[model samples]
Target chain A: MDRKAGFLFLSALYITFFGLPAASLAAENICHQQGLEIRQAEIRATPPNAPVTGGYLHIHNHGTSMQRLTAASADFSGHTEIHQMILEAGVMKMSPLKDGIEIAAGGHIQLKPGGLHIMFMQLKQPLAPSDMHQATLTFDKCGDVPVLFKVTKTPGQSDSAGHSTGHTHQH
Target chain B: MKKIIIIAALFIVTLIGAYSLSEYIARQLYPQNTGARMQLGSPFNLTAHTGEAITEQAFQGTPSAVFFGFTHCPEVCPTTLNDLTNLRDEVTAGKKTFNIFFITVDPARDTVAALRDYIPYFGDGITGITGEEEAVYALARAWGIFWEKNNITESGYNIDHTATVFLLDDKGYFKGTIDYHESRDIALKKLERLTAIR
Candidate 1:
């Protein structure tokens, strides 16, 4: 615990001295060391004036045992929930998972549209595709996994196959 | 007796083949006639995001895609809406009138502003409509939509409703329904058929 605190203190100082981008990368690397791995983390950004958005990412339990992402916190919203979307009896049902979802040993779960996802409600402001945001996911055993959520263009949308518009966030 | 048995077998095969062909032809000729299984639509009234009173009659003269969902949903709503928007963009050309109607079941919270900001984000020619719970419920019932509130939260609740996108013709007849979760190519084919047949 002391070592973790020391690392966070150094990271904060690094951010203050330099900038957020490098510190963000360093923070992600720190999160990777904590045993919970996040891949392809993206936040869906809509048009202006919208107050909320959805987030998707792949969480892998790199540790030898199972890990549970018990809760998640974000700087942008007051509330965060792990929700499930399912189609039952011809009805599309979206409901929150009261008991957090589990990541099996040596396995992973994908938080995606039309399946499981994270809901960020009461956003401080609208999410723009050009912007990046930070979210911290808490695990049952792995502690805090801070991630830099890259804003992706609206899900299930893109230009024609050949008529390509360049991605805004290459880095 | 052997000749009679052979003739009888041939006759049965021809009869079955003729029945199958006729059934195929009937489906093609009367594609809008979903009356055989379930009726497609009925009268509905609601307020559009633009704050104008609208009804089922407004969709009478243009091919429309009707879907029922809530604004606060995490995925299916936006994913399906994006898929439908892409289908519309793929099928529409030269001022073809293809309208998409998004009806919210959670009208208590899905206000005009919420929908106004949400629906247009998908694509143009789409209208977000909501109203009193009774009004929205009536519309859902008429369209054979099964929607109910579940997972209630302090902020709001998520709605369990049909995710199928109904395809209606210019005459307000039920042509068919495209399950939005289906592959985009399949949805595109149905949309293209709706436009080409028009």
Candidate 2:
């Protein structure tokens, strides 16, 4: 084969094998919504027979107006709800909010351990490290933003895509 | 060469059989307790969230569900309590009699008044209890409940504890613990099975 033809052939192979897959992966990671960004989503680890598990994330408001995140859903559970973790008289108390969590323009809300977060209730089955669950976060303004939550062995461990920090130990 | 191959195949088969048999025997000798099939029985008593004294005697002739958690716990406590609320509703709809109890390990912080407000948040007829540390410890030990105080700083401390919901028959003895992550239906089914046993 001619040198020029060989070089063209190699370039075509590289694009087909590497470039296309990388582009598709990037597209899969992208959120469908324009102004909403999910940062640092994580799920807590508990024993097999435990009743409940927790999820944490950071939501940034990139739009011009304020937005309210009212509800969340995980495919693994029957339902998910937003909860606030409060310390009353030195005891940590968690309460559910009828009204959804709000993020003002240019402001961000953090869902971390020992604080406000989401609770996955009535798990259909035991969550394993190999599993990846998808959740749809519904907002008043931004509409429904579908997020793929990657299950981890513990909190603070990043999902399979390796974007955010995992669990944090409260000392 | 044929003899050698046959011998190697036989050795491999023997090794596989040995491994499978050992695993099966080990499982039989020490069965794994998934905490799913266990039934929780009750009868221990302590102070209520209303600061009123209560005893297992008060719940006599009625089945009750008991959960061991402090009010300060953010995740497990509330979620379990909420599940209990749903469980109570389901039981009532089925026309069965049942009571729910929340025993606080952090009595120092979770006062009866606090429990009164907290317990009722999930549902009505739920009782929250707190007592002296030694008394609570004694009850916890008897039930095989495990807990430890952690993150003690200059200002405060956090506790790490076992999150088990104990189920009690009308007679108030430990029947078994509800699996921590069981669905409301599965848990209700287990409760029904326990209550039906004569």
Candidate 3:
């Protein structure tokens, strides 16, 4: 009994000291490869019959050369494309980016609502809240960056992110 | 004395012309409010998500919040519907009977089955409307709503549409509109005032 009690105490101490911080760190949802970092990666949960949904994230290129995000593939979607949604004079217009997006050296690009995002078309199944999806984002220079997107009901309501769609970065 | 009288007459004429021009500009700019209690839509037949044939009479008894969008829409439609759900809960508090409608612009894709599965994700009491393309277009035209489809990929398309939510009174008269991305506080207040109308 004493040995089991000691083990449980040690586990609690370890969780308080190490596990909690890791949980807090997960709020950023970042993936890094070859000096390219993707932050706040998430996919929006959709209604069961929705034909399409959006994935948003921020890309930071720390390398000295420009990188082009050319393509993306999601395990849950049959077709994935980089698309842009423009809200001009209360009209929302969306179009695909044929040439992909360019990230300058030491510059940042954000894929957000009312702006650039990943369009997941023909979903194999409906994405539910708290579900994690695996997607591979391919870049010209970085090859492929694997990311895990946390499915959220609202745009930025995952973990402690607390960033709502209403506050998406507007540029 | 004659010269003074002529100058006063010219000054009065300029004032009158300026006033008339301003009034004309106001009327041109805000034609929605100028008409006598703007009529919302003409009689039309459409299928609800419940698979029932409905007409404008469905909106005649209770104040309705109608939004024109499609299930394929990724961002705006879902966000607006979610916002409306929360706002309705807060504004009504289970006391008011407010109706919400989600009318699809892409009628070809948003069939009865499609909407039946989609509308339930949002809060309850929202009726999804879709019908033949021509009839849906006619209904949108009557409400002064605009929608157009743009082909991005060979097999995929997106729509450019008005994201405004139209508010109608219990008598089916157009009351006002809630613009997309309008402040939440203001939208809540608008719903409060709208539901208060009898």
Candidate 4:
């Protein structure tokens, strides 16, 4: 083929394959919110008819000012709340935080197993293994970031990319 | 044609005989402790996370990993659960198969709902079981679990119990126990070996 024709074909392919989808994703704002960027988001699987599940992720503050994560929401649960694992007198207890989780300016906070996390309660149904679900994380500043969570039999079972759905933390 | 037919028939007979002999040898070598062996091929009858009656019988015919713990347990219980979670992940990554059960000795406090909230914090395939104090005591004793509740100076209490994970075969017979102190990789290797032993 001639150079001009080849260039036109390549440009068409790029527009069809990459540009269109990128534009749509940008319009949906599935990755970034107001000023905060969600780095890695994951959810751990729960057994059949379980009432609750755990969600983990990392939040990075790209803005100059610190921001507080007030709450989170997902279609998978009736309610979502921020919780912290605290050691009180040798007991590891998980308590819901009334105040939102805070991320320092230019810093990052990790929501992992045995640490701070998002509690998904009142599950409508059991999260079966091999099922993938979407959760929308709402920040006090970032508004909302849509994340995809893959439900596996165990936590931290995702591929090296670190994208997963459900509560997965290691001891 | 007649010779071929006869050979095929002999091959089928040999296959059946070998299977039966292997089964007999396995039984002889693993001579089950009848008194210690839980009801074979029966589902577990325990309490659910909601405090209702749950029958292991409901989940029959699947190899399951079981552990005994309490909700008030601070370190060991959660640590073991997390370990089990890690083990489960490893097994899945290797395409292995198994189920898990978390039986609570603190029946008074670890109701079905409380377990419902607590157990799933670690992983998904784990089931939490609780029951009447007497039933729990009997089950623990039958499984050779020794646990004692010690009251602290403050308000709470702690249970010092055996930290071992019991493995049940698909037939619901007790296979073995994975000790608590073992490393995760070692425990997973043992579990994989146990499951691979047909």
Candidate 5:
């Protein structure tokens, strides 16, 4: 979790909503293996033919017991799912977790944009921030990692591989 | 130990049958998902990413802000159209003249040039409605709105909507609904009570 203090706390939230400098998209956001470390892995662009896009990252875990992330894969969208965005009675719902998202043993989970996201879904093309995708998360015991996704354009712009409180683009 | 009370009574009857089948499929696909205050969102004739032909009586002499997202919905319809264009630029900072309609309940992939290249990036006054899909499903069934499209063997098969952001009035009616889980000071006090009606 000391992963460069999570990309220096997501480059101070991409200098408060895209003043840029997510440190060149979080210094080449990696997929290193140590106890699950994958930070600043963005996606967000979608609106030139939008179909679905939103994947933010930060996984930490420094290992001990609890991990789970279950699934996620990408070669530039078709279906990725993970979604959370709660709120319930006050409305704002967005469900689809289907058993994945645990973390807790040492703890760390971010995946921003309105709360725990990843949903790349069906977007065959058009997600430019000059594009650069990869995504591959699956973990129940730290197996698949993949990570790369760095196409920022607002929505928590490029933390590339680090940050925490996702308020990166509220309007 | 009687098999721990028969495995805690079969885990409380499978957690009440998965909470009454997910509360009856969330009351049959979100009956306004209970945040209530519905009714009012009819009358339509979309098409207006600039090609004109809008209606609901040009938002009838003022007070507007209808939203029923799409354009591939990459996160709660652009975070509920950037929280209704930041409560319509903090209560009409353009000296009052609100009018936020962004219709398109997926008008066959939001055409009209994809809502004129997507509602000017949540700035400006914002107006983007796409037509014909039964006139955007009769303006999304007079606003009870609830899209579906679901998992369809996956391939980006996603649609599940109802992100709310209503608040019309000025004779267009339905004077409620804010939820993007509220707060922009409760959605600018519900868009200052719908631009103080009238």
Candidate 6:
């Protein structure tokens, strides 16, 4: 076989053995709501007795217009809000985003630990690890986007997408 | 040019000599700066998560890492506690005794039972402390921790608090601190130094 054809054959073989499995594995975590794409959606696993936890995800606006996530709800939580955590002058301050998080046209945003995240309170049941919990995210224009957030012990544990913010100590 | 370089070197040497002399005298005057034990924080009467009365004495006999936060805290508190658990394990490795103290800033909501339910997610070797609001705040003050309640909602309120984790020696003397979201490597090094202090 010619070098170019041989390279194509090897590339196909490599993709079959490596790329397919990863894509299929993460397929369950990725969700699509019309023009919006959500990836790496997960809820932090907390103690069975704990009443609160946090959820994280990445939202990409694949369409030509902007989208705003106004609210989120889960069957296991009585109260859910989009909250932002910021470190101001050595103080850790958390505030709810009542106006919601806005994603620009053709842009993306992350809701990760130590930054913006979904605050789940009054939990009816604990988020056990590896368990998938159903949640509905309400957007100003997109209506309701249903997602299944997999419970994880640590950030990026199930996927290699490292946290874009937080978890750093500058000495 | 050689003479100029020699003169510059001599000036730096003289500066170093003067600084060393001042540091020596200061250490002589204050023995605590020279490896002498210095206690920190005041005695406190509080309740542990185990539903038992605890005092500052519990912090003695073992090096401890203390943090102040409430159970209602969504991200910072739990994230810090989780990081502490992993860093402590890496530092201690079951070779020595190192305790972690989780002091609640919002005592009104963080009862003994509340802490018990919340702290278990970070694993063992953690002692949760909660009591009357005034008493808890007093203890936090003694340790140089500041907190304020804000954004009151119908459900509850949020607390703005210092996110530094205090490190103390076996004698309960202040050693150092690990800032919130501080790099894990530096935090691990601080814990190692604290554990080695005994």
Candidate of highest lDDT: 3
What digit string (tens of lDDT, one per residue) describes model 2 on residues B11-123? 99999999999878866764532223332323456788777788657545777777788755546676677667776777677677577878777878777766766676677
lDDT of 5 by residue, A35-100 (tens): 667666778777666777888877778767777888898876767778887644433456678997
- Per residue, candidate 5 scores C-alpha lDDT tens digits across B1-198 of 899999999999999999998888877886634343344766666679877888778776787877777877777777677667766777776466557877877788788888887888667778888888987887787667777675556354556667777776665666777776555688887787778765
What lDDT score goes with residue B187 in model 1? Answer: 82
* Cα distance off (Å), candidate 1, residue A42: 0.9
What is the lDDT of every predicted structure here?
Answer: 0.75, 0.66, 0.83, 0.68, 0.71, 0.81
Candidate 5 TM-score versus the reference? 0.32
Q: Candidate 1 regions off by >4 Å?
A: A1-27, A47-50, A156-171, B1-39, B93-97
Q: For model 4, how many clashes?
A: 17
Local accuracy of candidate 1 as per-residue lDDT tens digits, B1-198:
999999999999999999988888877876655345334666676899878888878677788888887777666677777778877876876457578988887888788877877787887888888988888878778777887777666765666788898887777676788885677788888887776655
| Candidate 5 deviant stretches above 4 angstroms | A1-60, A63-71, A74-107, A123-171, B1-53, B56-58, B67-69, B78-100, B104-108, B111-128, B131-185
Interface RMSD computed for candidate 5 is what?
Answer: 9.4
Superior by lDDT: candidate 2 or candidate 5? 5
Please give fnat for model 3.
0.76
Off by over 4 Å in 4: A1-35, A87-90, A157-171, B1-82, B85-101, B105-129, B133-198
Q: TM-score for every candidate vs. truth?
A: 0.77, 0.47, 0.76, 0.48, 0.32, 0.76
* Tens-digit lDDT track of model 6 for A1-171: 999999999999999898765553344234243467777888888764557788998888887888899999999998888999888777888888989999998899988887899988888887788788878888878676677677877754434435454322111
Show the lowest summed lDDT stretch of 10 residues, model 5 chain B.
B30-39
Q: What lDDT score is found at residue A68 in candidate 2?
A: 90
lDDT of 3: 0.83
Looking at candidate 3 chain A, the ten consecutive residues that score lowest on lDDT are: A162-171
Question: How would you class the docking of model 4?
Answer: incorrect
Could you give candidate 3's per-residue lDDT for residues B81-153 as a string of tens digits? 8888889989778588678999999999899989988998997989999999899999988877778789556
Candidate 5's C-alpha lDDT?
0.71
Question: How would you encode candidate 2's per-residue C-alpha lDDT over A1-171 as one tens digit per residue?
Answer: 999999999999998898865653444344324456676666754433443577778787776778898898877777577877654433345566679899888788887655788877666776655455666778886566666555554454343336434432111
